[model samples]
Target: MSSIEIHQFMCRKDNFGVLVHDREHGTTLSIDAPEEAPILSALQEKGWGLDYILTTHHHGDHVEANEALKARFGAEIIGPGREQDRIPGLDRPVVGDEHLILGEVLVETIDTPGHTIGEISYHMPLAQAVFTADALFSLGCGRLFEGTPQMLWDSLKRLRELPDETMLYCGHEYTATNARCALTIDPDNLLLRERATEVEHLRAAGKPTLPVRLGQEKKTNPFLRADDPDIAKAMGMEGADPVEVFAAMRKRRDSF
Candidate 1:
């Protein structure tokens, strides 16, 4: 088995687009098409051809370039099974827990519905990585646009169960703001304070803060820390259900 190669780049305003390649078989996959120009540029820069498009949801910003890319590369599109009608150029619709083999890698989808109905995150066990799209971020998760906080919480818990070293490739560059908000709620966290400083330095250098390790997020991301005693105490929800703590954190982030 060979390793999976990943290329992460900026697209649109704040969106981050990703490309995954299985070197052994030359199988190239794109997580979402936030835009056409950048994705095309990435492909050109890497001299890699796109073979598949795996979408997380039906948001316009995420799928707007699906048709154009498919037309250009003859790529097969796979996405949320329930939203095939909305996902332009969808060739295969997949629900949660389905597996797709890409060369030496196994791509699995987990249902993540808090950000949007039928949203999913792709986990490649061989690569120890998950393309979370808008469902989960470095130090934050997406808003509750189509589902409740509890739904998002459950979805996040699933991701949290992945190995600590799992790399998280999120959809946007929102870590700076997420870090600030995380500090407000988790002020006593030394790890979070250190991470906030590191995030500031990364953004100051105009670098990407993504592909964050799941273990680091467990320590610094307030949303992921709902079960931690320190976070629960800070939120004044000590002993409360993690779902309730998660809901309160989401509300705070929304207003922050």
Candidate 2:
């Protein structure tokens, strides 16, 4: 199998655009088009040409540049099967649990429909990475905009099941705010407190806090802690259903 290289950069305010390159095949794909300028710039900077655009969901910010990039590079576009109509320039549509061969790399699509009913995350086991779009974020999860809290919670569970070492590349740079909100709910958690401090320091230094290890998120992300007895107890929802606890946390985060 060919080794894969990943590049992550800021695009359109807080959104993050990721590029995945299969070195052996000399093929490069963008995780989401995000915005044309930055995506184009990144490709130029790397001396790579875009061959494909993989869309995770139907949100405007995520797919807004799909057509432009495809036009500019003549790249084939692959996106969620359920929302193919919503994504621009979709050449191949995929649903959950599908395997796609991009160069020598195997891209496994996991259907995580919560942020949007057709949200998908791309997992590359060989690369030890997952591009979680808006379904999961660093220290946080996407808001319940189109799906129920239970659906979103279940989606997060799928991601949490990945190997602890899997590096998470999420959609946005919202870790600082997520850290603040998480601290309010898990103040007694030593790791959570420490992670919050570290996140602040990284942001202050103008560095990206993303591509975090799933192991670290499991230890500190509040959304992923709904099932923890301590967190449930701290929220006064002890012995309640984890989904209920998750719902409560989501509500609090909404207002937070």
Candidate 3:
């Protein structure tokens, strides 16, 4: 059986640029185009040509290098159909709850609108990985830039349904800050405390705190635990609707 390889690197200060490759089919694609320089560098270092660009949203920071990379590598650009007009050089607009195949790998498109109205996440069950972009993060989630709190909470619920073993690849490197905020919300959570300590050490060591397992996030990420009774109790909102608790948490996080 052939294996898949992922190249994750930092771009544009805190954004992440990821390249997913299928060794069996000699197919390689990028998750997002944060910057041309870093994307080009990572591709060159891997000695692989880019075949496709899977865009998660229309944010400038994420799609700025779309045209450049496409022109350079003649790669196909796929993005959210709802925001096709916003994404530059979008060759294929994909909607949520759709599936496509790249080589022998199956790619599942999940609707995750919150930070952006048309944001989507890419999940590859075969690879046991999902690229969540700004919709979901290690210990937090994206701010409500273009969507509502309800929209974001709904989107997160969909993500939480993903298998426990799935690895989450988000668009930014804000885990350390998120950890601090998470502790404020769930101070008595031993797992969260330990994870926060781990995040601190990782950031201190100049290491990336990404590709966190979904199982870990389910237990530690406050945003994902909005429906948990314990989470609601911690927020002094016992029996409150999950969405209400989630909104309160998001509001607190905004200022945290």
Candidate 1 stretches with Cα past 4 Å from truth are none
Model 1 lowest lDDT segment of ten: 97-106
Q: Quote each prediction's TM-score.
A: 0.97, 0.97, 0.98
* Local distance difference test values of all predictions, in order: 0.90, 0.91, 0.94
Per-residue lDDT over 101-211 for candidate 2, one digit per residue giving the tens place of the 0 to 100 score:
886778999988878998999999999999999999888899888888889999899999999999999999999988888888999889888888999999999999989
Overlapping backbone residue pairs in candidate 3 total 0
Report the Cα lDDT for residue 23, model 2: 85
lDDT tens string, model 1, 24-83?
788899999999999999999999999999999999999999999999999999999878
Error of 1 at 144 (Å): 0.3
lDDT of 3 at 185: 87
Query: Can you tell me which runs of candidate 2 are displaced by over 4 Å?
Result: none
Clashes of each: 0, 0, 0
Question: Residue by residue across 19-87, what tens digits does model 3's lDDT show?
Answer: 999988889989989999999999889899999999999999999999999999999999999999999
RMSD of each: 1.2, 1.1, 0.9
Task: Looking at model 3, report the run of 10 residues with the lowest lDDT sum.
Answer: 1-10
